[model samples]
Target: MTEIVGRLAPSPTGALHVGHARSFLLAWWHARSRGGRVVLRIEDLDRERVKPGATDLVLRDLEWLGLDWDGPMLRQSEDEEPLRAAVAELLERGSVYPCFCTRREIALSAPHVTDGEVRYPGTCRGRFASAADGERELGRAPGLRLAVEPGELALEDGFVGPFTSDVEREVGDFQVQRRDGALAYQLAVVVHDARQGVTEVLRGRDLLSSSARQWLLQEHLGLPHPTWYHVPVVVDEGGARLAKRRGDATLVELRERRVDPRALVAWVARSSGVNAPDRIGARDALEGFRLDAVPKEDVVFGARERAALG
Candidate 1:
């Protein structure tokens, strides 16, 4: 049997909330079921937003949740050289181009719509220019953008099934490197996953659209594409999705409140209706749990649900 490798790549920008716990649980379960290795990767490339001690909080949370991962934890910040190398290779091959347009310029100059994010309009595609032959010493600070070809990028999601996205229609040419000298999420994630041999990706359905773009980048970089599984996202009573920045109910908070780890695990399982709320421990709950049994609908995390867990 082929080794099944899965990963939980979380940004160390805040505490790991319940939604993040669900994502990690799913990834861990998938890897354990297959007797595969689970990698813990810290996606802290956003230097400006990453808070001090956030990484330690993440590690403590995972350990508190009774999760163990193989190998030393990987940090994206330590892998910037390789990421830049990948960007440079793509630029030299004409697969990527330099973008000088700022976000404000693109927003004002293009017919962009807010599809939960600021969509880019291929405003700089025609204006893109290659580096001069003798300008090899121009350094790695150039803002590079991946040219999304005019075609439908498709992927077979493990849970969501068939998914496709017209990159030009949905999101125009996106950035691989920002003008501020930071690596973009889409580019960095693909590089890290490929380099680490991640065979499966388990994330929230909210990221399904972005997965299409990553698939495009994977092809351009000739990297091995991993199977994707997008789990349902946890929402609040108002149907608003939980966010790390929005003061959502976090695992650390619940732990501080003396909520049993097993109970929290059971809550996650119950949210998907994979197991009853009476499930006692992680091993039992996970043993009876089936990935196919998880509901595709959004799981609401209201006040009543919190009270029930306690």
Candidate 2:
């Protein structure tokens, strides 16, 4: 049997909130329940948005929750060479090309996707020999975009059942590298997950659309595709997704009030539609971990619960 490997990829760009806790806790439960190893990965590639010394705080939060992960923690920024190498390979595979369109220029023609990000329409896709060549033509560095194949890319999500998205129509050639020379999230995740041997990707359902994008990347690179479990996300009373910057839903705030870690764990379990005792540790929650126990729709956090996470 193939070994199962999971990851807790926390980007230290914002505060770690309850929404993050629920996702991380479930990821831990799913991996450990099957004697699998959970790899701790710090995704701090977006240096401009990354907070100073936020990784330590994230580590403390996870440790307080009593989740044990195997091996040393991996930082995405430290693996830039591998990421760049993947980009180079994609360029050579004829799957990706240089894009010289600026954000404003792309916005004029690109369609707004569900994620609120604009998808490129192949304006500069075949015009440049390379990104540097695009700079010579446009007088500016160019972003790199992948040439997605036509047809509906469908996959069975562990929690959401079968999900499909038209690669050509819905998601046009997406960006792999930005004009700022920074790697795009889609490409970074695909390369990292493949290189790290991530056999199972357990995260929020909001990223469901990204699955097709990443799936295509794996297919192009001849890499192994992992099983996906896009669990329901946590939202506020206003029905908006939770954010750490909001402060109230943050673990740091709850910890300040002396909230018990196990109690928080129990709350997360209940919130996810899983039945558990009042006080349960990370290990205890894994006693009967099943993806089906998690809700398919986003869980709303009312005013009262949001006030204290109790």
Candidate 3:
């Protein structure tokens, strides 16, 4: 049997918060309790939005919560060759094409499928013979988009069970590379997981929609698919999701106030249906940890709960 390997990937865009703690702790517990290896990956590819000190804070937060990993930390920006190589294969196979459509052009051409996402109308599909041709014709560098065919893709989530999404209808052909010559998140994540030999991907529920796209990339790239567990996200009392940019119940603030990390851990344990003491370390909560015990609904982290932790 293959060894189960899970990851605790943190994007260095903001300080870690209570919501982050819940997800990270659960990931750590789920992996460690089953004698699986936990890999810590720092997803810092979005350089424009990466906070200067956010990585350091992320490391500190994980340590404070007693979460540990089996190998050296993986930084996404340290290498780009693999990402470039993946794009090259797709381009060679004609699985992806150059897109010169701007945001305004796509918006004007296609209707909005979700709040901010537009179902790309394939405006630039086969519009150019080559990337240079698109640049020459449009007078602008083009991004690379995966050519998605019309069909409904289905995936079984370890937690959410069976799920289906029509990628071609809902998202159309999604970008694999940005117009500015940067790798897209979907491409980067698929390559990273495959290269790292990740077996299980346990993350927040908000990213559930992304699984289908990642699965598509994996299939096209001939990579193995990891078992997915999209657990509930932490939201406010009013059911609004927590935002890192808004500094919602950040761990940094709680630490500055000398809040006990174990208290927060214990809260998370109890929230997940584990009977934990008022203060318990992450490792202590791992003895009988069960992913099935975690609540399916979003965990709330409001002012009252924030005050209790602080």
- Clash number by candidate, in order: 0, 0, 0
Q: What is the TM-score of each candidate against the true structure?
A: 0.93, 0.94, 0.98
> What is the C-alpha local distance difference test score of each model?
0.82, 0.83, 0.89
Residues 120-181 of candidate 2 have per-residue lDDT tens digits of 67787668666677677679877778897779876887767898888777768888888889
Name the candidate, 2 or 3, with the larger lDDT value.
3
lDDT of 1 by residue, 1-310 (tens): 7789999898999888888888888788877766789888999999988989999999988887778888888899998988988888887788887776667777777765746565677655655244432134444344777887788866699999997888877878888889887889999999999888899999988888888888888988899889999989889999998998987998878888988887778887676556555545555565666788888888888899888878
- Residue-level lDDT of model 3, residues 3-33, one tens digit each, is 9899989999999888889999988898889
Better of 1 and 2 by TM-score: 2
Best of the two (2, 3) by TM-score: 3
Stretches of candidate 1 exceeding 4 Å from the true structure: 128-142, 276-279
Clashing pairs for predicted structure model 3, backbone only: none
Candidate 2's displacement at residue 213, Å, is 0.7
Residue 272 of model 1 has an lDDT of 58
- Candidate achieving the largest lDDT: 3
Candidate 2, poorest ten consecutive residues by summed lDDT: 301-310
TM-score of 3: 0.98
